[model samples]
Target: MSKLILLFGGLLIACLSLSANAAPLNPLLAPLSALTAKDIAIIANDADPMSLQIADYYQHRRGVPADQMIHIRFNPKTKVLSRLEFAVQKKRVDEKTPAHVQAFVLSWMQPYRVDCMSITTAFATGFDEAFCAKGCELTRKSPYFNSISSLPFRDYGLRPTMMLAGNSFEDVKALIDRGIAADFSQPKGSAYLLKTADKARSSRAVFFPKIAEGFKGVWPVFYMEKEFIKGQDDVMFYFTGLTQVPYINENRYPPGAIADHLTSAGGVLSGSKQMNILDWLKAGATASYGAVVEPCNFPPKFPHPGVLMANYLRGSSLIEAYWKSVGMPGQGVFVGEPLARPFAYPSK
Candidate 1:
């Protein structure tokens, strides 16, 4: 009996080692505790009251160091910035940022696009005219994707940026609180990857099977075809393509849920029939992404559901996981509380 027990224990150990080796390296598994308040830099437009308020609230809530707060004076209502204006503003931000800062939080909605590149991408890789020369071609890849380093800029020379944006200050505050609540909770939830009849938007459908296999046992993965998901609770992640409003009102997403719809103008803050990404936040999602400019239904320009789920399940922050999922993000604006990490520490 003693010999049998020993053999069984040895086999268990061997199996566990094999499983660990087979699993892909998830950078999000690295704890945010590894990052200090000093590693984040918050930017606000001095002329925008909402920007100032959001920046202040995020700084206080995240415990970011006071020295890391950088302010600039720019047209707060403009949706696009000229090359020269963007260059000057980027220079100002770069100068004010401390060398140790690893991530950036832009507290504004307008000026989401700089020339042809999204403001987030410009800040991460610096503006490249080549990226804008072709509207449909693949843009540069991010160095921070699948990276193990928590200090992205220090390790990979790339600073991941997220906009603390919404329709109003009150909304932004609520979003921030939700992110704070998600830390280390590891709540039970599901990831819904939907396939619609629209072929251009349905490109992600090919990845659904792989996602289900990859995330099996980690979370319930649901794959739907030509059908809408509704009235679900504890929705941890959702991705789909739709031109108009989705059936989000029918669902109840928990605090850390990451949801987004792939539509051309989802990033447009106002006056569009397409659902705004901010509506996801309003509907209880903690983070979301959308294209500020026309991306022509390119899957690479948007967040890949498989990549996002894989990283998030491994405990990556919302911003990090979402950012890594996009192979070309020059046209998309990422919105959400950047530090929401529900799976960072497994729940007891």
Candidate 2:
């Protein structure tokens, strides 16, 4: 019996030693700390009260420095801007922003698209006609994809941007607060990938199996039918299709969760049968993406679930992950908190 006890003690010591020798898990995600207040520039349309208000709220909530706030004068009512008008605005932003500012927060929903390209894409990589020339061809590749550097503009010459857009100032404020809350509280959640009836909109389904495979032990992944998932308090990621709402009332999304639908005019702020991207924010999602113009069934124009999930799982900020997922972002506007990094730290 004493020998057996001695043998057990030896086994316990060996196990502890082996555990101590094992390598620690390196963080695969980028947290909110990756983006400093100095790294972001907030652009506001001085002519628009709502734009200015949202900008002020975001700057305060995110603790963005005073010099990082850039004001530009433009027709705030217009939904689309001509290339020339956009160029002038872009020039102003370039001139006003400090050299170190790596990302932009546009404080309005209108003028989401500049000619054929989304304002966010144009601001990131400048306007490239090739991106809009063909519907089916590949677009310009983003240099910031799967990038390790937080200074995207400095490292890759690309500045990812997101719109602080919503139906009202209160909603925008809530959205910003949610982003901040997410940074403070990193919740355990699941990523839901839906298989909808619409084939064109459901192209992301093909990548669902792979996404499940990738997130096996890291996070729970759900691949379900067209029905809206309900009563889930930990929905960190969701991708789906439809024109109208997709029954989100039943789900409770944590502060950093991302949800978006694939449909024409989901980006359109005005009248459309489809639900607007801002609605996702209203419904608790911290970030979302949509095409302002008619992008047809072009998969490149929309966020690729596989790329988005992979990058997010790798610790990329919401803006970087979403921006990197799209191959052709010329017509799509990214709306949400740009710096929400729920997966930035290692899971406890």
Candidate 3:
């Protein structure tokens, strides 16, 4: 409901909606021209062992074309890259990228942030200050939000990107394995949208009514007012807001399942006080989103549940659904298996 906000005088009036519009609310049950392995370019840090290994494994696993693999050299230890330094390397990446490529998968976890913007955003759309917010103000809006177009790079000159990020080689391999396993495997899964107690962070809940209404017969919609879900055996989509989501590992996330807790700095995969988005991957979720910086509890800074599930159920790939869900993604870092498409079918 980031777009639902309206201001009068000096007051920030919160607007809530129950509109079940078909476009984003009741998405038609149909396959989309999802971002495929061929449409993605893998950006790997050759200097980092983990980056190289993950890139190689993902390439073979997803059948990504040999030419799509992009290798660059950078310091492996730096978690944050300076804007000036990143621009030089990014220019090289831009020159090497094929025009047909629609998105990217950054293989390394470190260097996740470039100045105030997430590395994923930096790589996808270039380092633009319009995407960065100074205070609680809104940043640049993503052109791909709830969009029907599949050719992002060609159309908007923006590549919707994600990261093959995990703690270890095995962890990332397992993550990719889950993605490969999800292809065309439409399992009976449940979508969990928790309206937690955190008022500020729970800003995305405005769209829950419409989302729940749309997924009524298409999927199991579980809209609960709780802090966390535990011991669930089949969680396909779990959305909530909390600083530290407890018992996340106790729930089972099927392949291609998307789960995320809305909080500041969850995208700070390492050395964050909040429960990192990596924990979502470790706990079996195939994809997740978080803010690498302090993106105040504005719904635009996080994934819109309505847009995400609607796009995913309509058969968009994990990366597409996640990227299109966020209105303002400058601060948010998207990390997931790029090609998971459980709900997608082969084009007839």
lDDT of each: 0.75, 0.74, 0.83
Which stretch of 10 consecutive residues in model 1 shows the poorest summed lDDT?
A: 11-20
lDDT of 3 at 26: 22
Winner by TM-score between candidate 2 and candidate 1? 1
Q: In model 3, which runs have C-alpha deviations exceeding 4 angstroms?
A: 1-30
Tens-place lDDT digits, model 2, residues 106-185? 99878788888877888887777765644555555555543345577888787889888888899888888888777735
Rank ordering of all candidates by lDDT, starting from the highest: 3, 1, 2
Residue 158 of model 3 has an lDDT of 96
Clashing pairs in 3: none
lDDT of 1 by residue, 164-219 (tens): 88888999999999999988887888888888877777766766766665555446
Measured against the true structure, the TM-scores of the candidates, in listed sequence, are 0.88, 0.86, 0.92
lDDT, residue 264, model 2: 79
RMSD per model, one decimal: 6.3, 9.3, 5.8
Put down candidate 3 lDDT per residue, 123-145, tens digits, no spaces.
99999989898888888888777
Whole-model lDDT for model 2 versus the true structure? Answer: 0.74
